[model samples]
Target chain A: AQSVTQPDIHITVSEGASLELRCNYSYGATPYLFWYVQSPGQGLQLLLKYFSGDTLVQGIKGFEAEFKRSQSSFNLRKPSVHWSDAAEYFCAVGAYTDKLIFGTGTRLQVFP
Target chain B: EPEVTQTPSHQVTQMGQEVILRCVPISNHLYFYWYRQILGQKVEFLVSFYNNEISEKSEIFDDQFSVERPDGSNFTLKIRSTKLEDSAMYFCASSGGTGLSDTQYFGPGTRLTVL
Candidate 1:
């Protein structure tokens, strides 16, 4: 079974500071990992995904994630956090099936 | 840019009543999906639809839940008898392909509250 774990329940960062959200996944084979952000009263937006090829992938809003197979981690990172970046982040893994297994989200709070 | 759209941002239904949540996926997408998130919980996959049939479903999608694509543009999820546990934000998503690399775009969820 595919599963995801986002160990950080909440994180607070100063505005313009670096941000890194940790994510770890479990799957038998190669996993399709994804990072999604959910703003207040908004839908889940895809930040980036790792399917194959390069270990690092860039996504919208200046976000990027590096896939580390050895550690089974695909952590999201942003060099500078903006106030609007305060939101809930989720990590997910997809297996042979179409379904996605998601982890408990991490709430990001950006302080000015 | 095309995106998935869902109706009834919030729905309040009495326990034992039926409720249907609607969605309009991206015009060109071929695969549709339904997911739910209870308060303080992770999002969960409920069902996936392709070629007008269910390709896969999670254990949470049981007899009480049903889905339909009545027309070309609309996909719907129906709860036959809403229960208190059914209270959650339901999200609809669509993907251009079923492959692992394909991205699934989500719509603003419909918050269902059963009392």
Candidate 2:
């Protein structure tokens, strides 16, 4: 079955520091990978997605993700983290159907 | 920018009672979906609807659950008999199409607490 894995349960980074959140996925066919972020009591917000073509994808809020087919990874990165960037991040792999298989999520804490 | 909207940010209900979660998808979107995330767990797909009918559903969406698009604007998910295990954050999403360029836009979600 298609699934997603976010190895880091929690990550802490100081303001203005670089950030990287790891994600791995398992799928049978060509995968449609996506990164979403959720704030406290808020809905999931799309960060970026990789369907095909270029491996590096840019998204809203200064977020970017790189899809590595060999490693089966789509890691999210931000050069400078802000205090407001603290939130839970999820990785998801879209199935052939409409449903999306999501990761367990990684809680990010931004320190000042 | 247009967005999917859901009603009642939070709901508290007793077990075995019926609860209906409502959503108004983006006006021009053609596909609608429901997903839930249990506390500390991955978000799971419950069901998907298109053309006024269910396109697909997961095993978690058993006989206890049903979905309907009553009018041009409202899409709803109804649980006939709510269970304590049903407590979670339910999200409503919609997409213009299933094509490569189409992306699903999610609503803020409704937090259901069944006791």
Per-model C-alpha RMSD = 1.3, 1.2
lDDT of 2 by residue, A1-112 (tens): 7789999999999999999999999998888888999998899999888888999999989999999989999999999999999999999988434678899999999999
List DockQ, one per candidate, in order.
0.69, 0.68
Clashing pairs in 1: none
Locate the minimum summed-lDDT window of 10 residues in model 2 chain A: A92-101
Output the lDDT of residue A35, model 1.
92
Residue ranges of candidate 1 with Cα displaced over 4 Å: A95-97, B98-100
The TM-scores of chain A alone, one per candidate, are 0.96, 0.96
lDDT by residue for model 1 over A51-74, one digit each (tens)? 999999999999999999999999
Give lDDT per model, in order: 0.93, 0.92
lDDT tens digits by residue: candidate 2, B10-71: 99999999999999999999999999989878889999999999999999999999999999
